[model samples]
Target: MKVVFHPDFYQVYTSDPAAAKGRMEAVVKVIDPFAGFVTAEMADHNDVAAVHTEAHIDEVRRQRLYPVAMLAAGGAVQAAQIGLAEPCFALVRPPGHHASADASWGFCYFNNMAVAIASLKNRGRIDSAYVLDIDLHYGDGTVNILGDKSYVTVHNVDAMRRDAYLREVADAMDRCEADIIGISAGFDNHMEDWGGVLSTGDYFEIGKMAAGAARRNSGGCFAVLEGGYNHDVLGQNVLALIQGMAA
Candidate 1:
């Protein structure tokens, strides 16, 4: 699989510089170490307007912020575009999905996965998308954007119970008909992850289940790393996720 990454991705941050740097460093270590993966510098900011409203885009620019959230969202859009041509992974940071339509919150300026899905829909390339968000936090932004849209099916898991959450995820996978699967894979859902209540095993199980769904659908699957503060657990879970995808 082709993995897309940019070194400057670490520079875009709206929160503590230290935390953002830590996450970026971890992502780089994992992706850059692997050979044959294509690394592309994100040079275009034009698509920001395609997924985000003018007011929200203006706020991000005026604040002189890192635009990490926007970039993350944009990166997902780029990856999805690549997915149309070939499978790809978007390794970007400043996790989005919390930022709502009318406002930005929870360290997200624009919903990256949402933006990517929207772009695909607008281009008539995708008729349906299944978004599986495994972050410890609910993907409120994605839900808000997809609530009335029949083309998007959102399965958000943000609870402590593993079996129940997995059951919910399985049900959604069984019922939803989608041409592509977008996984908002966040290691924060793991117990060892910062402020997480589920174990690393549970996180792996979730990934496996999601991958199984993707395989069953025979549709392209793209996973974007969202949030996970613990380096050790994050690394392990990410590897497990890729393995699950391969399974």
Candidate 2:
């Protein structure tokens, strides 16, 4: 699978764990040997503006976060575009699930999913999209911007049990009817991670289900990194998902 990434993602963009040192390196160490890498570019300012406010964009610049944030968004766009043809993963960060159109928090600066999906819609590549956010936390940012757009349906899975979560994903995938499916792949729910509700194998199942859904709908599928924080096992978890998607 092609992974959209940039070496700059290795820079500690913030004090948040999502941008902590070695976080990207840990995942990179494991996937580098097998994963095909695609260099990420900075998102066009117009694309960023399409999903964010001018004030929010300026605020990011004031905090010296504009450059990297745009790169992450750009990586998402690249991943989404690649997904139209094949499965891919955007392994870039400053995880954007928590960001909104006008505000941001939880280690996010811009809503990358919103930007990427909106761009695809704007270019007439997809008429509708399904977003599956499996992060430990809700992806309110994505919903805040795209919920009312009519072209997107966002599902943030928060089942408390491992089996329940998987079932929730299965149910959603089974019901999906869209031109594309995107996974907000987060590993924080892993047994060794923050949520401690899911196992590493679960990610693979989620990925496989997503791939199946896309195939069934004759659509495309892709993923972007979110809130996995356990460096020791983060790489393995991500790899499992990628392997399943590629399979």
The alpha-carbon deviation from the true structure for residue 55 of candidate 2, after best TM-score superposition, in angstroms, is: 0.7
Model 1 collision count? 2
In terms of lDDT, model 1 sits at 0.69
> Quick one: best lDDT, which candidate?
2
Predicted candidate 2 versus true structure: per-residue lDDT over 1-247, tens digit per residue: 8999999999987788998999999999999987999999999888889999999999999999999999999999999999999999999998898889999999999888989998999889999999999999999999999889887999999899988989999999999998899999889999999999998888989999999999999999999999999999999999999998988
Q: Where in model 1 is the C-alpha error above 4 Å?
A: 17-19, 31-36, 40-47, 84-87
Query: Tens digit of lDDT per residue, candidate 1, span 1-247?
Result: 5666666576735554324656766655664544235554442455556556778777877866535555566678777877655455677765678866667777676677887888888779888898989887888988877656888888886556767776777777677567788888777767676645666566556656666666677666777777777876666676566556545
Collision pairs in model 1: 73-112, 191-198
* Model 2 residue 70 distance off true place after TM-score fit, in angstroms: 0.5
Q: After superposition, which runs of candidate 2 have C-alpha atoms over 4 Å from their true positions?
A: none
For TM-score, the strongest prediction is: 2
For model 2, the run of ten residues with the poorest summed lDDT: 12-21
Clashes per candidate, residues 3 or more apart or on different chains: 2, 0
State every prediction's TM-score relative to the real structure: 0.86, 0.99
